[model samples]
Target: MATLRIGIIMHGVTGRMGMNQHLIRSIVEIRKQGGVTLANGDRLLPDPILVGRNAERIAALARQYGIERWSVDLDKALANPDDTVFFDAATTQARPALLKRAVQAGKHIYCEKPVATNLAEALDLYRAARAAGVKHGVVQDKLWLPGLRKLQLLNDAGFFGQVLSVRGEFGYWVFEGDLQPTQRPSWNYRSEDGGGIILDMLCHWRYVLDNVFGKVRSVSCLGATHIPQRWDEQGKPYRATADDAAYATFELENGVIVQLNSSWCVRVRRDDLVTFQVDGTHGSAVAGLTDCWTQSRVNTPKPVWNPDVRQTHDFFDDWVKVPDTTVYDNAFKVQWELFLRHVAGEGEFRWNLLEGAKGVQLVELGLQSWKERRWLDVPELTGREGA
Candidate 1:
């Protein structure tokens, strides 16, 4: 059997997302499953070189993963003939240059979103990859989320007729690390680190809206930095310059409205870290990452406000929980398998750099809306002409 050995330059593999999601959950899990079996009876296995600046961390991760190849120098890895793909999970500020170099090096590209901190850099990355004739993709993990899939199915089945609006509530209190250590890195609270709820989450919202609701036409956003100060890993105090919370309203092309509230300083008492309640003329549905509850107008009872008498209605009981029929793995892993299939010429990769650019575009308009204190129009990306 001929081996289709694919080498990946995995930058920022030491970080949380890199360590947990990319390395442990996706790639390691894939390998443990005996790799992806092709229809031709061939197997596709990734030979990823863990790349980072810290030697001790790299060594520790290498030992943890049982992988031999590791590198501190990115240039050397990028120059390697064996490395066919460059995967970036680095900070947003570092992604543009890294992606440009990778494209110029003639490697396939896959990275976490928003691709870049701004639209121009994100657009440039797409154009460069296109010009270099290399396959490019971005992580749109939410599209593959299990609970959301059921919501999509319900929408497709017309369980929610003439969709009216969507409300997304996502957040959990991030410890200041003064008394309790923060779960996320301190960089996530600094603007210089490309850390803001609006930039980070609106990218996800764009894909969700495009995939589930409708194409977003305009947005009005309000951003806030509720947690003004925080402590780093070492107990050093730093001001939280980036926004920890964002309240945004988007108007879709289909005239359906979306109200999203994202926060890192709020308490979580909901079903999941993220909950989306989508309402239509006929019914409503609420979905988290793993569970979905829905109710149609047929099952909904009409009610009127009465101050004289006690109301008799079982609102929460009216909604029915949607059973999970399809098995689900990690959201990003599902996308990864699809991307691998796409790269192998077995299927199409719809979530390309252009789709990533749309995400960047939405974030840009959202920032604009926040700054200008007015609704802003979202312009189409260069590659979204026919889309």
Candidate 2:
């Protein structure tokens, strides 16, 4: 079989999401699987060059993953003619400028979400990529999640007939680094470094709601910095200026109401770290990251609430687990494969930079809602074709 080698410059891959999800789990896994086969009998092989600030770290990553190329100089990597694709999973503050440079070099761009810290910058990146006439995409990996995919399947089968509302609970307590080390990077709790739960997670919820349920029409949000002090990577204490938690409500254009609670301070007591409960007229399904439990209207149990007596009913027993019908790959890897195929002119990719901008817009509105203490209307982002 003929092999078409596609060169990719992976930047900021030394970071947590970048290293684990994009590089090791996705690209390395694809390489291990003998590359992606196309319909025309040609296989697409990825030749990724790890790019980062630290030479030693990048070299170690390359050696660990069997990657042939590693570079500390991003400009030199971008200047190479063979590297047609540029992927970034860097901090939100550095994204716009990095993407701009990539688009100028005429490279196809794919990146982690919250494409920019603000809607204006996010829109600028989309416009630039469009003007450069390059293929572009952003990570909305939740759309490919198994549980959410099951929800989509159920929705398609009319299991959730006339959906009325959606409730999403996402978050887990992160150590404050005093007694135990912090699980997340300290920059995540600093506003100067583009850290905040609203900016970080609202982007995710926006796409999940828009694609899975309906387009978000408006939003009302309240934010809090639950842990005011946390230790950094160097074991130094720092004041947390960014919000660690957010309670947000969204109104969908299709009349479905959505509520999401995202935090790094709250403990997880649900089926998974994240769960979405979709309530409909005929049935209801509660989906975690990897599992879904559904309860049909017929299976719904009726009970009267009485504070005086001890409750005997087991509420969890009423729902039936959704069976796994097919093998599922890593969500990030699935999106990466589709992006590679799209870059190769195989099919359409709807989640472009414009969609990324929409996510940022939601983040902006959510913050505005928090500040104003009222609901904010989410206006449509116009001027881009197929936006």
* Index of the highest-lDDT prediction: 2
Tens digits of lDDT, candidate 2, 272-331: 999999999999999999999999999999989899999999999999999999998999
Q: Candidate 1 — which residues are off by over 4 angstroms? A: 1-3, 306-314, 384-387
lDDT digits (tens) for residues 1-387 of candidate 1: 444667788998788998899989998888778677777878788788999999999988988998779989989999998889899998989999999999999999999987999877887888889989999899999988988998999999998889999999998999999988899899989998899888899999999999988999999999999889999999999999999999999999999999999999899998899999999989899999989999888987677888999877767788899998978889988888877767777777989998988988888888888898999988766663432
Clashes of 1: 0
Best candidate, TM-score: 2
Whole-model lDDT per candidate: 0.89, 0.94
Q: RMSD, each candidate, Å?
A: 2.2, 1.5
Off by over 4 Å in 2: 383-387
Candidate 2 displacement at residue 334 in angstroms? 0.3
Write down the lDDT that model 2 would get: 0.94
